[model samples]
Target: MRPDDLHRYITERMRMSHVYQPVMLRELLKSDGEATVEQIAKALLSHDRSQVEYYEIRTKNMVGKVLTNNGVAAPVKDGNRIVGYRLTGFGDVDAEVRDRLIAECEEKIADYIERRGGNIWQHRFNAKGYVPGSVRYAVFKRAKYRCELCGASAEDVALHVDHIIPRNRGGQDDLSNFQALCITCNTNKRDQDDADFRGVADSYGHREAGCIFCEVPADRVIAENELCYAIRDGFPVTPLHTLVIPKRHVSDYFDLFQPELNAIRRMLDELRSSIQDEEPNVSGFNVGVNAGASAGQTIFHCHLHLIPRRDGDVPNPRGGVRGVIPAKQSY
Candidate 1:
């Protein structure tokens, strides 16, 4: 299917479900008609250098999935080199895509009002230090006429002044509470609290394109013990594919202590029990882990996949995890 067709399907499905990759690849492309993973990361992460690579890899992967032409979406290559990413047919965006973004905007507006309305109006609505003209301009100048989120410029994109503390979080309309953010980032920050607004922008809600394996959001969490937690996969190969993760942010599977391992194991059982109780059609299972980069680990965080499988989900399921190695799958 064309990218436009895919977008229509996505927008319709999103009404009843929560999806993370609601952005189209073309929406993020620069005027040069392509964007590197790192460039795209800055657009999403803004100035957060602490977790660039984690968001970068996921953005790179999402390019292949969401940006398609004739049902094929992959990176644009220049003879054994990946130059960047792009999507085809860019006159006017599909109405579905536009509607999806609008819906996202509306949801965020409501969330912001619900969370910050009373407190912000009480303090900064008509309060004295509500900086607007010259002072707000200084914040933009300090950020170099660029969006503090998404890295958009005054040339290509309009910017907005955002409260770092936010109205609900004791933020006033004064200079101290303000920062320069693109409208996209400001809207995406709606579902997030003050502390996590920037951190989880690319991992949760509609605009996300980050390493969900390592950066699982609290909302996706299903069950947890003292040491381990179970989170539903953001992009699951199968329904109810859940990950049992260690609470302490260790990367390697072997790095997990016995207590962490035991906690994960127990959570696995709890997840399986709940799946059996809830989804009776789910049959069989695929339990596995990807250890390192070469071993297929994408996020660098130790996570165990407990994927539920049904009888006829695939044409053949003899090889199971050995499907990871297509050449040696027969035996």
Candidate 2:
């Protein structure tokens, strides 16, 4: 791409596009041919590199993509751990083009401030970085220092910084998009926020066990695992009523294996925020399991209910699950 086109892609799309990779590339080349992604990101974004701190996965991804696309930087992977990248080839940034790119970023920032109304200039102006430290702390706290995926506390597992909506899914690295995950779950969810969700509906079309859960398309699935999946309840009792069902066609919840139960529980926690994003008024929940025909188990397939509770779905909110038995619902 032309130098001007590359600069436009970075400034116009950096917040939203993986195409900004080349902008990050220029900074990597400016380093003695190689540097940490953060190093490259900071050099590209800030006037003073010391003020540069851990900002967004957005930056690292752009840098990595640029390097990977150009076939110039090779990652130093230690088993599951990716240590860093080393520059192997040089399709570098010349001084003239580099100056031109910086100038373009400044102009865009000024234009953005004029169009929108925010003192976001701290960000708009070659922001040392877009995300501030305050936001990161808030994201961690909002997740209650727990793995937002498996509900494991930081004490139980190492914590992680993650994007609730991944970049591959066209998500920005903004505060609302941030989330916390334990190391293991984060590793499983890595890079999946985008492509995997899109492919889910079509990937297992042949696994039809003749039941709704088994044959249901992947798009209907809110979350899933190797053994089972979760979906919005077809006929919702509440706004975000959901069902977690095993891929197996077993009729009773008692028949669910330990792993399937574990997968359902994990997905329940992960899907909560996603539900609330659609309907913010959710105040509580009603989790239920109806076992047999006498208990009004109509579907015959084992499915766990994840019904969201609102302030007043009915006139009387008394007796909770006992309401299923009517007269027994009282005393």
Candidate 3:
């Protein structure tokens, strides 16, 4: 039979009878903690009481048979009553079964919701006035079909029109604060908070240069080209990392203009290229701009990190900027 036919047959068989009771029992063990025979029987009662009893007896008999066949010692006993059964070593069958049942439950719930005029996709936070087709097309054109983060141009990989500053934290809904990001980078930035520019300045031993990005000397001057800046004497993860600033700082990526955006991009490309020339075997790079404190952006000045990643770098290089600081310390 064809694979689809086999799949259909198996599904039909599963739905027909209490054959899947053992699988359910395993799932119960994993989720509801250790189960007594009574608990197991109660679960199987949903199928059929007679079937449940049969399976319970079958299960115990099968276990005993397996133990005897494997030449394992019999289960312990307390004066003619079997105390407990323990297997040698371990197996995670219960976990596997539980995951399958949970997935089935989720699918059923999703189907029920769909039937009731509720959309599963509707729960996702869609930006107001964003047409998915237009946004996707614009991002593709703007980034030239390449990942704005890594410069990868594979069409199979869907690109994201990401907000440089997240909308939840007062970021304006505009194209200037948008960027074309790859799946990896986009996933990484989710829920990240904008970096605190004031705190960063304090850390870097620089007086609040009054909106350093736009050269606004003191007073929160709301102006275009407002950038944030940061200094890294010795960057924790990457060496010699310094971030450029934009003064009239907006937290979203869609709020940047051509001139300011071009300048930052050029600087990063030049930096990466120069580093590659210096170190022949530099495998990859990590360029990040945190729009919020949660995302690990310490300075609010629209600053971007040019981190050079090499082979045998730090173990498990996940968490991007957050990985730089100890868990207890705030960035």
lDDT by residue (tens digit), candidate 3, 50-88: 344444444445666577579663665689866566655
lDDT of 2 by residue, 92-201 (tens): 97999879978998999889889886665453342433456787677678778888779988665556566554555544455545677765566556644445533432
User: By descending lDDT, how would the candidates be arranged?
Assistant: 2, 1, 3
Q: Which residue pairs in candidate 2 have backbone atoms (N, alpha carbon, C) closer than 3 angstroms, thus clashing?
A: 201-218
Q: Estimate the overall C-alpha local distance difference test score of candidate 2.
A: 0.63
Candidate 2 TM-score over all chains jointly: 0.35
Best model per lDDT: 2
Ranking by TM-score: 2, 1, 3
Task: Residues 1-331, candidate 1: write the lDDT tens digits.
Answer: 5667767866674453212233224424343445677766555554333234334444554545465534544567899866566645445898999899789989998999998877745632435435658877777876788887678886655566776655554444544346677655665564444454343222212222454544566777889765677877766767787878776667788986544564676678778889988899987777887777777676666788888877777644575442222221110
Q: Clashes in model 1: which pairs? A: 43-150
Lowest summed lDDT across 10 adjacent residues in model 1 is found at 322-331
Which ten residues in a row are the worst by lDDT in model 2?
Answer: 322-331
TM-score on alpha carbons, each prediction? 0.33, 0.35, 0.30
- lDDT of all predictions, in order shown? 0.62, 0.63, 0.55
